[model samples]
Target: MKSIVFTFSFVVLFTQLAMAQQSNEEQNLIKLSLDKWQWMADKDVEKLSQLFDEKSKFVHMSGTWKKGEELDIIKTGRIWYKKVTVKDTAVELFGNTAIVWNRITLDAVVREQVAVNEFTVTEVYQKNGQDWKLLALTFSSVRDTHQIKH
Candidate 1:
């Protein structure tokens, strides 16, 4: 009876430790996704490129789906973000892949037009070695519909 109890206790302790380690991994992945948003706000295309995979795909809010990587978008003058505010951010992890969804309001100059657009953005990330890299992204524009009672 004593040996059986000892074995059960060890199994429970090991399982809890494994769970804690997995939680930390998920949190770190979410942080990496958030950092990409910061880089976009700063217009740091170089840093942003590092976060993206070589074959990453980016679907812009304009309904254009770009292939290749962030460099292609940066070269075309198609994306110029000024101020970006992330809201209601949520992250979910599945094995080595993670997805981050958030509401983003941006003061951007796209195609020479200064616009304030609210969008729901989803960023897909994959863990590579010790770092997380963005594998794809899709964003859709949302109309801010708020009623003010007079």
Candidate 2:
């Protein structure tokens, strides 16, 4: 009876430790996603390029693009991200893949026209050996007529 009880306790402790580790990983991924947003706003192409996979895909309201094309657009001021305010974020991990959903408010300039928009953005990251590389990013515009009280 004592052995059985000890085994159960050990299993419970192990499960808790595993859960804590997984939570930490998820939190780290969330921080990485936020950093990517900031990098975009700042037009930090070097950092962005490092984060994005060579074959990464990007889907925006305007159109879909490959990594190089998107980077070029940012580099040339075609789509300048002025600010990004993340309202909410959720991250899920599946094996080596991490998926993140961010509800964000963006202030940007597209073709020299100022644009303020809300978007539900989905980002997917794949683990490459020990590193996480962004595999895909998709943005859907949110049309909200209500203003925030705060």
Candidate 3:
């Protein structure tokens, strides 16, 4: 009766706490994603070069390119990532690999023309030694109503 109800409540509380708590690795990965976004907006190619794997791929609507080309684009401001408003973010970890999905509204300058777009950006990362390197980043245009289902 009362004893059983008390035990059930304790169990439920414990389970909810466990579910709400995230591991350190998961927190670090999410932070990395957020930092990457800021670095992109800042055009910080020096830090970006270190974060991006040598064979990393960047896929955009117009074309796909490797790390060097992507760095060059950022450095030269051929397409400036002026601002990114991240509406939602979700990150999942599988062993040493992590994937981050960000639903964002991006304000950018392309060939001196301003473009505002809503997109879902998928970023894949792999642990390399003590650091996590970005392996791939792909963008998919989506509507404003899109949500990240974690």
Candidate 4:
């Protein structure tokens, strides 16, 4: 009974360690997703769209749900992000899927009025073949501010 318990503990510890390593790898993939977000803020729609899967979904802070063709959001001009900075990020992995949570501070002019918003964002990514693509994203706006200094 004692030997069995000890073996089970070791197995659990080893499994946890292995999972942590995989999570780290997923975090690295999430770094790429962050790069894509930066490009979106810069209005590089083409590049940003490439990072997402074809059937990806987005739930905007404004309570709008978008499905497929992320480029449409850029082309329609319903939203625009000029500068975005991500902070306090956490990445978790579940096999071929990962979730990235972060606080995003954005500088933008919505409806021709310049405003700053601090938002909490979560992006889900799935491994597609050798590459990881964004599967879904959801964000909530914390506040609208007058300006963002840096």
Candidate 5:
């Protein structure tokens, strides 16, 4: 009876430790996603390129493009991200993939026209070896009727 009880306790402890580790990993991914947003706002094309997967796709309200094309647009000042303020974020993990939803207020210049808007951004990241690369990013404009309290 004592051996059985000890075995059960060991299993419970092991499961708890595993869950803690997974939670830490999820938190790290959340931070990475936020940092990516900062990199975009700063126009750090090199870092952005490194984080983006080769086959990544990006969708904006105006259009959609692949990784290289999106990088080129940022590099050439065609679409400049001036600022990004994240209002709320949620992250979900499915095996080795993570999906993040961010409600943000973005200030940017598109085709030399400055615009500021609120959007709900969806970012998908996949774990590759020891690193996580962004696989997709899609932005949808938030309706003006819904106000986000600062």
Candidate 6:
């Protein structure tokens, strides 16, 4: 009887989750986050520069820097984001702001050495007019077994 009850509860919970739909804005934020990851890996600093606000900030394992310094690092190959494999992503919206959390495995080249690490990347974006600009991007190192609660 206990096993049967557990099975029923699991089915109901899964059904409810599947039926839930994310709003358009939430979906757009998710898409933008994914695109940003791709742009970083490709070293498309032009698009990134446009997306990042003038006062934007970036936090990495090595250190933290402002928008200009971050762009210069990417342009000069100081730290090449060779590949990023996103395991999962979550986004929250407030008025005109959105925060995204991405669980990823990063494979990068830094100072001629390649390293792979797991990180939970948090991105904060502000909506202005018809576009959204990134205000902050922070990387938090995490264990491979770590998971973000939804």
The backbone clash count of each candidate, in order, is: 0, 0, 0, 0, 0, 0
For model 4, the stretches where C-alpha displacement exceeds 4 angstroms are 1-20, 67-69, 143-150
Tens digit of per-residue lDDT, candidate 6, span 6-98: 999999988777656446678889889889888888889999999999999999988999999999998888988999999988898888999
Lowest-lDDT window of 10 residues in candidate 1? 141-150
**lDDT tens digits, residue span 8-125, model 1:** 9999999999988877876776677677777776667788777888878888755545444456555565676677777666777888888877777878877798988888778898
TM-scores of the models, in the given order?
0.73, 0.86, 0.86, 0.72, 0.83, 0.85
| RMSD for each of the candidates | 5.8, 4.0, 2.6, 5.9, 3.8, 6.4
- Residue-wise lDDT of candidate 4 within 37-128, one digit each (tens)? 77776667777666778788888755555444446666555567777787667777788888877777877767677878788777888988
- The window of 10 residues in a row where model 5 has the poorest summed lDDT is 141-150
Model 2 residue 5 CA deviation (Å) reads: 7.6
Candidate 1 C-alpha error for residue 67, in Å: 5.6
lDDT of 6 at 41: 85
Query: How does model 4 score by TM-score?
Result: 0.72
Q: Using alpha carbons, what is the TM-score of model 1? A: 0.73
What lDDT does the true structure give each of the candidates?
Answer: 0.74, 0.88, 0.92, 0.73, 0.88, 0.91
Tens-digit lDDT track of model 5 for 1-150: 999999999999999999999889878987998899788877889999989999999999889999999999888879888888888877788999998888888899999899999998889999999999999999989964444342
The segments of candidate 1 whose C-alpha lies over 4 angstroms from its true place after superposition are 1-23, 67-69, 75-77, 143-150
| Clash pairs detected, candidate 6 | none
